[model samples]
Target chain A: MIIIISFFSFILEYLFNYLLKKTLFLPLITLTTTVIVRPFFKKNNNLFYMFCFILGFLYDLIYTGNFFLSAGIYLIIGIIINLISTNMPNNIFTSIFKIICAVIIYRTLCFLFFYINGITIFSISNLFKSIYSSLLLNIIYGTLIYLILYLLSKKFNIKRID
Target chain B: MHKKEKNKRTIIILSSIILSIIIATIFIKKNFNIPSYGIKDGMMYVNNIITRIFGNKDYYKLEKENEKLKEELEQYKDYKSLNEELNNEILKLKETLSIEELISDREYAFGTVINRNFDYWQEKLIINIGKNKEIENNMAVISNGNLIGITDDVSINSSSVILLSNHKFPLNISVKIKIDDNYIYGILNNYNETTGTYEIIGVVDNIDIPQGSKVYTSGLSSTFPSGILIGNVEDVTTDNFDLSKVINVKSETNFDDISYVTVVKKGNK
Candidate 1:
């Protein structure tokens, strides 16, 4: 189930990256975090981190061309999300809040990495634009994935850590 | 439970070590990213077909635009004979002076642009042709009959082009500005985003170069062929240090609407 979600997100990322204009960024990180760090994969921390690392490694290999950069970023973000989501309430509103927080952390980490590496020029305006432009679609995507998993978890015997 | 805890700790330590080693290697060695050449090319090919089938464009507007371009092309046709005569005269002069001939005669590989990742949209573009098409690094790419960029990285089935408008990368192409049969050479290195102009610096000539003069590749550099049109001078000014002239050039080629490009393959540059 986790692999299916990861693969779906990967395909969507490729399609959206090619088809969509520069303004609309499909949040692959946000979508992956919302599902993999949820109750379905809670007890399997090692597997969760492995999935994040591999997904990020593939992303770097194909898209970014900076090996291990996104892998490390995704691993750290996954760990942070897991630690936080364990304490938060497992409901619709809290899910939305978690998505928002995840996006903020993700963007902040990316900005810091890019800035430190001198990959991008120092521009606060550009950073803010990247963050805001991705918010609307990512929030919707995160929430929808959460709702689907919530329904599936009820039907099956997936342990809910929260 | 004790065994599970130990296993988890082992996994954490191993992961940390592996990640650190890979990161260190990447930092030490440039161009370390593993190339997924086949997979990327296949995905791009699929993307091209999908976009073609579901491309959203106003056809009526495009038809009208095409008609307008056809009329403009007719005007250029009138100057074709005069242009040919001048080119012939230039060739004769070069032969008489024992000068090296420009690479006006070359093979061109046509390719469709397949991807422009938003993160590097301004910096680079991925094209369908690569090593398979004999494309090499530093080859010049043109679209809309104007020099747009140069090929940077070539994979098995695709290539990445570094656009001139990218500020993230340092792009310095030697160019010549024609002023009444005299050419002023300079280095084009800066692109002004707000003004939509290119800045050509390092021109040490102490002469008056009028605005609207045409810019072309000097061919002094090995990367680009001579006589490829760059743009027209929009403004001319002296540098702050008052050592050399800086010319601002405006290009007619629209960077935002590029879909097809041709890579010029020169022989033994």
Candidate 2:
């Protein structure tokens, strides 16, 4: 369980969370620190906010065709995900919601960017195809992510590092 | 007691992040067009190379076409003198032709239909020839004496050819009837999910041509050679309240049965 978690969190790129939003920050950050930098500090504050910058920057690069748009969004998402996760039950359900929101926020933002340019993101005939794909994809992948994280928590005796 | 407060704070942070992403998206749109990257470069070239090195299955189909062509060529060779005389007669009838001297002298490269991709939105096929075999874009694809379609795009080793039946190629087709030499033009297109069926939406008169009328490409344009076989015409009917005839075309080169084809390399280019 632990090995699979570490592998998925780090290696498998292009993990989707919502109908159209694909985010990689949670996996990359969680895996890198959990597998590589866990001993450096028993507790660290900077890790929580950093994911947002990375996520926003990456999204901006791919979606908005600019820099830092995704960085800022991700930075904010990271902070939010971290903060909610800290106070929540931290169960399978919590993780699922986390993923759903992460993807929804990302997709909505991507749509907004296109919407502002007077081009309709949802207006295109193919919008439903994209939306349908996202919905079906999120349920399957989100469940897999939940299981991997659950297994990791048990196997390596790894707690939530953050 | 303190944990509840933290949960509230977390919710607030999440909302703020979403709000900011929304605002930022609008700002970016006002500045630049939607920021999205295109497909990866070099993938097409690599796919072509891979298809070639692996030996395209469509090669079998093209080989079959080649065998048929060879028989036709052999038969023509036997009657070479008659062919020359017949060709001369046809040539004199249309002396002031649209073809330039060099293009008129182009030769057809042989290939085969290797694979077929069909859906409700797009229908496509693959051929065995590629850059390794000297194939290029917009070169007319043909059989013994019929038009198919032009190449979609070319790779170093293989080129993707779009059939005339594809929805992607929308242009006027000028078909001259074999009998009575009656000329009829129509909009010929392939629906997304149908194989071996293309429609002519604008037939002008009731086409009483019986089943199995041979269809040919009218080489009104440089895209196709004159008199290349397109398909067999079926379901010719005229509609009320509409000025044109509806045509159901059953193509001769069904992707299902195609094992060989010729990529007629016009002028060896």
Candidate 3:
């Protein structure tokens, strides 16, 4: 039931932004509508949840030592992002902003949660730097993912299943 | 469609995807790894020789190295016995050891440096030594304070060296902190270019090692002559930073200046 969750090493900057209450003014994630549903089952209402769930699933798979943290975070983020974007049409830029915001938002929540829980030894400065670095890295990753989706759209003739 | 029907559809899809992902996690965890692609070991050197013949100045430097090695070969063969005695004493003290057993039996073979994979992804220096030269897998490869790496793949006249700078590479090294009397053991992992993170890992465990220290190979792993220069310590972040300390080792041998290299026949040449 995650709304958004993502990983990036430059999370420190984002943390700084949050502590300063500075709005990023830039999103760091890229969203991808499902290719399978967009192509065949044009009315695949559950597609958003599926994609979000899989995103978290992949995050978990990539970093196994963290246990289920990535997967849990991914699922939560997926649900949240998809729900928030429910009314918005799947325009490429809109999806991009939503994904980017999702990453920062999730990371912010994690830092606050960890800080409140007294589990982390991070100062606001370190946490902010971590967020910033993670965000920068996530932007690169998010861009590449978006490019692949663009290629998929062109090659496979897929579109938003609306 | 009815609201109830839509909610059910969403629930079913999310559950199924999440469930499948959970199941797939087992497979992905075990199998979903990045495929390693590179210029396979041996052809690289032969290619270098050809590239040199056509007036590549890089080849000339290697020609110079070959001449130097030829001279060292004669001297190395002469003092194998006295070197063996020093090898024995050191081996006795090292437990959880690698090179000690190697030196005790005096088992080693000679190999020559052929080419270095000086690319960004892999910093490995490929050598023209293999099982034929008694070079086995994981044998430490060093040339002066410059630790090249350990042997990986071996053919008749060739073996792949996993360089110290390789992301996939890990060396069990001991740190010589200027401030502390004790030596700490840590694994040196390569720098992640995208993240700009270098790990001198394992210090986050039991050892209370701090930043600004020096890291060296614990000749205990193999015959690396223990106190050879390793690297300078950087900020000591959490163990979550990586398996190693985020060490920034400014290597004595500038990567570009590495032309001549000597492969230590640790036990006996």
Give per-residue lDDT, candidate 1, residue A85: 70
Across B1-269, the per-residue lDDT of candidate 1 in tens digits comes to 98999787768846864674467346524544335665676676666666786555557877998999999899888889888999789879888998775566457899877777544446678888888889998898999888888997688778889888888544578899999989989999777766879899999999898988999988777677788888999999999999999999998887867878999865433
Q: Give the number of the best model, judged by lDDT.
A: 1
Better of 1 and 2 by DockQ: 1
TM-score top scorer: 1
Error of 1 at B171 (Å): 5.2
lDDT of 3: 0.49
lDDT of 3 at B120: 21
lDDT of 2 by residue, B49-139 (tens): 4446654545787899899989889787879989789767756755766443433335656664433321111224556566667776677
> Candidate 3 versus the native: TM-score?
0.38
Residue B153 displacement in candidate 3 (angstroms)? 23
- What's the CA RMSD of model 3 in angstroms? 13.5
Arrange candidates by lDDT, highest first: which order?
A: 1, 2, 3
Better of 1 and 2 by lDDT: 1
DockQ scores for all the models shown? 0.36, 0.11, 0.04
Instruction: Kindly report the docking quality category of candidate 2.
Output: incorrect
Instruction: Kindly report the fnat of each predicted structure, to 2 decimals.
Output: 0.24, 0.15, 0.01
Per-residue alpha-carbon lDDT of candidate 3 for residues B144-163, written as tens digits (9 for 90 to 100): 55565677655555666766
User: In model 3, what is the error at residue A31, expressed in angstroms?
Assistant: 6.6
